[model samples]
Target: MSASTKPIGSARGPAGPLESRPVEDSGRRGLTDRVYEEIKALVMDHGIEPGARVGIESLARRLEVSPTPVREALARLESDGLVTKRSQAGYRATELLSVEGLVDLFDMRRLLEPRAAALAAVHATDEQLDHLETTVEGMRSHPVTGERYLVYRRFAALDQEFHDTLAAASGRPLLAQAVQRLHTHLHMFRLNTAPGDALTTVDEHDRVLRAVLRRNPDRAAEAMEQHLSGSWERHIAVMDGNPAKK
Candidate 1:
């Protein structure tokens, strides 16, 4: 009955028929993924407060499962930067970026994204441009209201796709890889803000797409700069106006 010695589902007694074993195995695998998703939802929805240590045994008991799946889920979350693990500290929700840290992050983004946009303007093929337009259309279709959480997720995906496509269209593989490594979209979602910024983001993306489509590198770069600057200010304002929002 102790936590450390608990079996996940061993109380089922003996294994079933050989054919049915795979179903059991599949179900077991599904449990781990389900646990992962539930934990992720807790983190993303701020159900578990930020910077709080996640107690594995407590979570397992709450979910009516063993600690193994919870541990597995925490491992995956750590990789996604939603959870942090220390030497002996186990896991805690990743803390919000400080205002100074946010500034530094935006500074790096400003240096690279504008250059990428300019290169994309010069080099993007017709096919790439079409893809970019499609991404923009998808973003525009998802207004930042109603189910704001779901809409925010969709908009974030389209936004990531839009930027990744643009970075790749720059015809520099390394540049694309570098941009992807930053994991900017994931971190932004972890900020857990209302969707007000999403509307402005769509407009900024439109401006960038327009400049790229027009083959104006200077204009593209300018638009990208404006977007980054505006985004930084918006985030800063949100963080400052409501210290408890994060």
Candidate 2:
């Protein structure tokens, strides 16, 4: 049987689970979270490249944390699909994307996200619109700062946040939850991209914003879906997995 090459537009809005707001640990053992979140971010930040064998001792030193937390964090990362454990080596970063997998994912997007955008347009409030505008403008103004460099490591994350913001504006928790779960898999296909990819992304976001501001659900959803479709095609090249450019 042939495989489905859908973009999982099923992620139209963040339809599944809202990322739990960072939780506070009531007890001392919970402090390990410092190491947990830090190490997890480090990986997402590309402190570790996919398929790169990670040395636990070395990473602990880099993060200025003890081996215990670093090791513990890596365990969590493994569960998250952000890292892969090798039988011979301790762990390595997971591949950002495989062409075959992405084809199917995009196909799904073609199904879900456009509809989500339309719903968001109808439901989003004034505050959501203002926040969306601020996010886009911030990206434009700070196109190439040190923080921008930070973004390169986590473009997948920034990409998710941008989308999630709009989904949240829809004020539907289930919608955001579903989309967030979908993106967790989506991050796996990441390939390095030019700053232009991000800027163009922000521009498309602007279109969705403008459409939503007008409360035109169809236009907003189409604008958002078209924007992501164009993005996946244009930057699909980045996932070729060449040595990441510095």
lDDT of each: 0.75, 0.61
Per-candidate TM vs. native?
Answer: 0.76, 0.68
lDDT (Cα, tens digit) per residue for candidate 1, span 1-246: 432223322322232122132112246779888778666655664556578788899777666678898899999889777888988978888877777767777888887899999999999999999999999999888755532233366777788899889999999999988786676776766674447777788899999999999999999999999999888888777787877643
lDDT of prediction 1: 0.75
Residue 49 of model 1 has an lDDT of 57
| Regions of candidate 1 where Cα sits further than 4 Å from its true position | 1-35, 56-73, 146-151, 192-194
lDDT of 2 by residue, 79-184 (tens): 7677778787777767665666667667766666677788888888788778777777765655532222233434444566667777787777887766665663
Model 2, total clashes: 37
C-alpha positional error of residue 132 in candidate 1 after TM-score superposition, expressed in Å: 1.9
Worst 10 residues of 2 by lDDT: 1-10
Candidate RMSDs in Å, in order, are 8.4, 11.0
